[model samples]
Target: MNTSVVDCQKRLCPLRYLPRQPLSDPQASSQSASCVATSACESSALSFKRQAVRRSITPEFAKKVQSRSQVPVSRRSMRLQAIRPLRSLLHSKTTVSSALRPWGARGFASALVDKQVEGERITKVAELASEQAVRVTFEDGATAKFHKLWLRDHCRCEHCMHPETQQRQLDTASIPMDTPLHRLEVTDAGDAVAIDWDAPVRGTPCTASEFDAQWLRDHAYALEGGNAEDEDTAPYPKSYRQPRLTTQQLWAGADFQLPTHDYNKCVDNIEPLMRDLYTYGLVRVSDTPNSMEATEKFSKKIGFVLRTIYGTMWTTNPTNDAEGYNDTASTNLELLHHTDGTYIRDPPGLQIFNCAAQAGEGGESRYVDSFHVVETLRKENPEAFRVLSTTPLPYFTVDNDAHLATMEPLIRVDYAGNVVQFRHNDYDRAPLTHLSFEEVGEFYKVHRKLLEVLRRPETEFCMRLQVGDMMIVDNQRVMHGRHAFQGGDRALIGCYIGRTEYESRLRVLGII
Candidate 1:
């Protein structure tokens, strides 16, 4: 309602905004978000990459790189990315690198949130040993070191990246990993660097790439001298110099206020609601029409509802739907703190629940930020944390028509060891056959440990959802359930939204 999707996509689209490409399923967005996050992990991963380089380039460089290669292959093989441009300048008139311009776009919006503060331009270029990387220094003592293969892979020309889709066109694996640089120099204007490669990219002999100077500054991973693992990692930029949420507001019930907005007013704006939802994992809106129509309208303002076994729009009231729910959620039984769709590979990211009818007693809705819970587990019980994160468990839903199942760790984290998704639902669990005998015992032990942190009074928020009350929840990060109620009928109408769609709005608002 505040900013249209077209406006956001157009700003980033190299050409004109076109219809979004179709996704095969709801989880497609979640899968795609991982790829996007990995690509954007550049600036932060740089520090990690640099430490590996510093350790490997010993006085005995060749021997250490081989005999003493201690860095994990997973970390070493991670593609070091140049921060992507806000608007890919692939069509830029400059033809310096491989008939393409690289990571350039005037350093994003000149005054988005704040004036764009560009670092010093390229002052000098140095080719490090092993012919693996280049260090570009800036005028103001800032420096960025980039890998040779990474530079070739991220070239953003019409030949390398599709101009319309803004997706990579060049075959990354086909390119030589150690593509030697025939020549590398800072441009005369000091705003970009020009390079000529000795090996072919995707079998194309013409290997030349021009990288924007400001692009290098923002994306550059500065080298840090260290032979040991970093116990304390320095803070790194998360976006391409755009505004973003630096930290999630980990809270108990006391620190939150359920941000409320009337449905009528929300039609005019939804930014305030989104900001709160992203920070707190959930929020409540009042005075909404008690119908699925209103629920979907509110959902579409952010993104469309994800269709699943329960269909797009669903309800817990056994009286309302003829098909009837096959799950206990429709009954008057206390559901434990857990996420929905545990059987699906990528559980829904956001869940919208609009209470149409209320129960006179009990049936109070409950929520807990699993991110907060897991972080507590990390500190309070590091061993438990390791077990839950590394061990995989099976989840399943076997109905007459559908038999859905998947195996994954309960707490899914990213390369930086931050919680990305939480798939915890004891009720939906299948047999414990996925883990080894010893690991199975450990899983149960840690499961209890995690629940202890989860069920604490301060960590939970409980409220009886009332008529016209709507809740938006990050199902991936927040665990939600309800208490048993008897006397009055409790009905909740809701649907799910993918994580990809949720973060797209965050990007549009520059709040990622």
Candidate 2:
């Protein structure tokens, strides 16, 4: 009930007008006069009025009125006020607890983390070159010296890179024994290095890291002034731009094989070979029997092995599947410089191809190192690179009706916006949805640029395989294509390996 209405009822009662106290202290005067008046009124005819009013106010209604008076001090309001500071304190406590955990205990958080902390931290071998090695101080205050030989061996020079090939041209013997390293100096730029060494006893500068003729003159000990600009010493991009496996590092074998002559011994080589593929995107096996059926058997073996881990074979079985309408597998010379399965979420981890025959003709297989292409694109066309890197192209999949398709972007990024993988296939491009026509045109333009880079003769490397030349690669990083074959009826067998087994096999061999 409204307080005004309650006051009106009180006034109407016979006891209401009896109190008369106008005093300096309002609280004391109202209490005393109201009490005396209440007693006098109860004693007289007003007693009937008091009893009626009391009877009208039910216990539940009185309780509700009392509850309304205590609204500001309710349990929910009190509880929320009580918990506000505590919630903040609890969050702070959790943050501190996580920070206190041991370095080794962090979860699979990142590969970069594992590589830096676990592998590079402890195993960064010391260097004793003429130049000063950069000292890597661990969290515990201990430091390790990294040498120029180590730098030279693991040079990221182009000559060492396998743009389209995975051959290790660095024979330790190739490093001159007589060459004396004077000192080692590392520049902050792109981790570049400058080394001063004694004159080569034989075969150019021995123990040189990415020895371009121009680089040699720039840092050469005996450079004549006039000979610097000579055509022979013309400035060229460093050969060390190529990627290479670190010297003396033995990788565990899982799938790929090096030059093992014995068949039984090849079993042990699998993990390292697989690790090489994981790290470098490619690996090779030599001296298998030369036959198309043999190649198929090799491919099938890889498939069967992969299925054990992946749980299902995801090969595009063109012969049996009606869904694979656009699945074209031909012996025809198509330079398919394209990635496989951009339509799927996680594409194939590894691709295994076995060469049936190499008739010594022009049907040599070509591989484009997409990773190297990415590096090149970054260097040459930074603006175009930024556009391609920022924009997303819809990677797609379709049913028999090309109209019915699902699409995702060709480039996938993490929450922090790091480019994780690139998935693109011309075959599975779905129609643009949110993007404008102009944006789509820009996408195609950049895409075509990427394709052109892939097809460049300098960018791609070709290898003619003899019978029994089987290769496995990280499918996401490498793109394979073939040349026009003059000889009749040549075929290669292929299969895919998923990443789970590919990695587990590496761990089993202790390579990772």
- The candidate that wins on TM-score is 1
lDDT of 1 by residue, 315-335 (tens): 886564346558878777899
Report the backbone clash tally of model 2: 26
RMSD of each: 14.1, 32.9
lDDT of 2: 0.43
Which candidate leads the pack in lDDT? 1
Q: C-alpha displacement of 451 in model 1, angstroms?
A: 1.2
lDDT string, candidate 2, 406-437, tens digits: 35555444554444466666766666676788
The TM-score of candidate 1 is 0.75
lDDT of each: 0.65, 0.43
Supply every candidate's count of residue pairs whose N, Cα or C atoms clash at under 3 angstroms. Answer: 5, 26
- The list of candidate 1 runs beyond 4 A from truth reads 1-118, 203-206, 222-246, 320-322
